[model samples]
Target: MVTIKDIAKELNLSYSTVSLALNASPMVSKTTMRRVKEAAREMGYKPNAMARALVLKRSGIIGIIVPDITNPFFSSVAFGAEQAAHKRGYNLLICNTEWNDELESHHLTLIVEKKIDGLLIASVNKKNHLLEGIIKQDLPLVFISSAYPSARCNFVGIDAEPGGYLVGKHLTDLGHREIAFVGGKFNSFSVQRRYAGFIKALADQKIAFNKEYTLSGEFSIESGYENGIKLLKKFPKVTATMAADDLIAVGMLKAMLERGIRVPQDFSIVGFDDIFIASLPGIELTTVFQEKKLMGELAMNILLDELNSGGDSKREKKSIVLSPRLVIRNTTAPPHSE
Candidate 1:
C-alpha cells in the first residue's frame, strides 16, 4: 500500500507538494512535478479511489444497466462501453435488470446511492416511473435503447422504425405477398415502432396488412423457435418472415431447418441487429445492422462528458438516432418459381 507520503518522504518533499504534482496543479513547478511523479511511479503508488472520491466529489465510476446480459447484442454493447471507459481511465459498473422493472429500479437506486458519476441505461420498460424520478434528481443519464417519450434525458439508439420498414420492403420486393413478423412484446416502444414501420411499408407496396401474421414473443431464442413453429403451422402459405432481432431470426432459422423447410427456397427471412451469430456459417442472415458498439461508446461518452462538465453546465438533453444499414446475406432471396 504505497502512499503519497512514502513518495514525498523518499523525495524529501512535503505531502502537499506530492499531492499537487499528482493532481497536476498548475501551481507546482514543472521540474518539481516531474521529480514527484517519478518518485510516485518508482514507489508503485496507487491512489485510494474511495478517499479521492470523498475529497473531489467524483466517484470516477459509471453505471450501465441493460435489459438482458445473455443477449449477444447487449453483451456487445457492454464490451464497447467497457472499452471506451477503460481508455478514459474510468470504471464501469454493469447490471442486468432481466427486463424486470423492480430490479431495474433497485439497480438505479443502488448505483445512485453508491454515488456513481453517471448512468447509461437500457431500461426494462420505457414507462418506468423510476427513470423519470432519476431524471428529476438531475442525475446525468443517457438512455441506450429504450427511452421515455417525455423524459428530458439524453438518448442514443437506432432508428428502429426505418429499419423495420426496410425489412418489410425487402421481403415485399422479393415477390412475397404472405409474410409474418416475430419477436418482441407488444408493450415495448421498440416493438410498436417496428410493427408500425412494417405496416407502413406494406401499405406503400399496396399489400394488405394481416393481423394474423404478426406474432408477439419474448426476445429469446426459445421464444422465437416456439412462436416460429406456431406461425408457420398457422400460416402455411407464408413465404417470408421478419424478426425483431437477430436472436429471433436465429431461432426461426433453427425451427425452419428442423422442419426441413429450406430458407430462401421456401421462406426467406430477415432480422434486425446484425449480431455476431447472424453471420455464422450456416446462418448468414440478411439483417439490419445496428451499430451496437458505436451506440454503447456514444452513450458512455455522453455520460462521461456530463460527469466531468460539472452540475452547472447547462444540462444538455441530446437525442441521437443512428441509422441502420441493411446487410445483404445468404438468408434473403426471391421466392422460388415453380
Candidate 2:
C-alpha cells in the first residue's frame, strides 16, 4: 500500500527528486539519495516492478536455460550467475531443458514472451533455428559453457580443447598408450572440440588414434555407464579413458567398479568439470578444472554490459574463454602391470 508518492510527500521533496533518488541516479546528491532511501524504508515503501518495467522498458530479469540443473556442473554455474545478477539488482529466471532440443526451443519462446532483458543458455545443440531468430531480434544473448557455432553473440566458457589435451597428455605420460575417449553427443560443440584436442595430443606423442576406442552418448551417468560397459566388452585391453564431463566420468567409474575392476590399478579415468560431487571421499575423480562459478559470473557480467550498451549495433561481439587446468585425484594414475 506504500508508494513513492507518499514517501516524497513525507520528505517534503519533489516527485522527480524522490524518483531519481530511489533509482540511485548520479544526478541526485548522495546525501539526498541516502535520506530518501532511509525515509522510504522506514515508511515500508516497496517498488512496483510492473509499473517500473513499463516505464523503463526493461524487466530487470535475466533468463538462463541449462541442459540439466541436477548435474552439479550446471548447478554450480547457475549459482555463480545468480550471485552476479543479485549484485546488479537483477533476478534470474532459470529453465532446465533436460538436454532436450524441443524443451530448449520451448523455453526460449516462453522466456522471450516474458519480456526478459537478457538471456543466457548452456544450449543442447550447437546451432538452433529458434536461437538464430532470437539473435536477429537483437535481444542480448550470451552462451555459457555451450555455444552456437553459427551465431554471432557473446560467449563465456573454458578453452575445452586444451582441457582434453591435458587429459590425454597426463594419461600418455603415465604409460597409457591404449586409451579411449567416452563423451557426450558427438555433434555438440564441446564434445567435438574436446575430442579434437584428445586426438591432437595423441598425434603429438606419435600414438595412433583408434576410432574403435571412442564412444559418444548423452552427457549423463546412465549414458556413461552404458558406454563404459560397451567399452569394456569391446576393448578390454585399454588402460585409460577420458570423459566429457564429471557426471559421465562418475558413471563410467561405477561401471568399472561394479565389474570388479580396481580404479587406477586396472584402468584410469579422467573427466571434465571439477564439480562438487567429483571431490567426494571415495569418488575423488581426476578432472579438468573449469571455473564454473567464474564462467557464470563472467557470462552474467557480459550480459549486463550488453544491456547497458543499449543494444548498440556497432558493439563488437565478445567471446571470453577461460583457461582450464587438470586436477589430479584418485581416479587416474599410471597403467597397471600384471
Candidate 3:
C-alpha cells in the first residue's frame, strides 16, 4: 500500500526525484538513490505495476493461451514460457480454452482489453481469426506448438511430420508391416503433418499405407479408450499402432490390457509428445520427444524481440521448427515370428 509519495515525504524529496531514484535513474545521485531505496524497503513500498504500465505503455505481463492445461504437454509448455518470461523480468497470465472456440475468443478479448504486452499461444483451431485482431492492435504475438502459416506471424513449433516419419520408420524397422495410426482430431495441422510423415516413411520403406486405419477424436485418454474399441474391431489385422500422442497410446494400452493383449508381444505402440506419464515404470511408452520447454522459451523470446522493437520492429517474420527425437521404450518391439 506504500506509494512513492510516502517515501518522498519521509525523505523530504520531490515526488519526481523519488520516482527517478526508485527507478535507479542516473539523473539522481547514487547516494540519493541508495537513500530512496532504503526508505522504500523500510516503508514496505511496492511499485504499482499497473500504474507503471500506464506511463510506459507496456503491461510487462504476457498472456498465454492453451487448449487444455490438464494435458502434460501443454503444462510443460506453460512452464517453459513462465520461466523464460520470469527470467526476463516479466510475468505471465495463462488462459485455458478447454478446446472451445468461444472460450478462446473471450480470453483473447480479455487480453486486448487489459492491454497485455504480448501473446503466446497454441490456439484452439486452425481458422483462428482471433489472431488478426491482436495483430491489428500492434500487439506482438507468437505461436508455439502450432502455426498459422497464412498469417505470416512468428511461430515456434515442432517438425511433426519428421517426428511422425520417425515413428513410422521405427515401427517398420521392427517388422510392423500390419500397422495403423490412432488418435488426433481430423483437422489439426499437427496431426496431419505427423500422419503425413508416417505415410512418407512407410512409402520409403516400400510399405503400404492404409487410410481406413486412421481415426480422429479429441486428443485425450478417454477418446483413445473409446476409439480403441472401433480401431481394434475394424483393424483386427493391425500388429502395431502409432498414436498421435502419449495419452492416446496409454489409453490404447489400457483398452488392450483389458482385452488380455500384451504389448510388444501381441501389439506394439508408438506415441508422440513424450509426456511424463509415458515414462512411468509400467507404461514406458515409446514416443517422440518434442522440446516442449524450448518451444515456449523461443516463442517468448521472439515476442519480446518484437515488443522491444517499438516502431521499427517489422523484421522478417520468423518460423522456428524444433526437432523431435524417437525415444524407444518398453512398448515397441519387433513383431513376433509367426
Task: Name the top lDDT candidate.
Answer: 2
As a TM-score, model 1 comes out at 0.85
Selected candidate, larger TM-score, 2 vs 3: 2
By TM-score, the best candidate is: 2
> What would the per-residue lDDT of candidate 2 be over residues 125-239, giving only the tens digit for each residue?
6566777778888888899876777768899998789999999999998989999999888887888888889999999999998899989888899999998899999998998
- Model 1 poorest 10 in a row by lDDT: 307-316
lDDT for 62 in candidate 2 is 93
Tell me each candidate's TM-score.
Answer: 0.85, 0.88, 0.85
Evaluate model 3: give its lDDT. 0.85
Over 4 Å off, model 2: 1-47
Give the per-residue lDDT of model 1 (tens digit) for 197-307. 988899999999788888988888888899779977899888898998888888898999999989979889898889998988999999999888888899888877666
Q: Per lDDT, what order, best first?
A: 2, 3, 1
RMSD of each: 4.4, 3.4, 5.0
- Model 3: ten consecutive residues of lowest lDDT: 305-314
How much is the lDDT of residue 71 in candidate 3? Answer: 95
Q: Rate the local accuracy (lDDT) of all candidates.
A: 0.83, 0.87, 0.85
* Deviation of model 2 at 140, angstroms: 0.7
The alpha-carbon lDDT assigned to residue 17 of candidate 3 equals 90
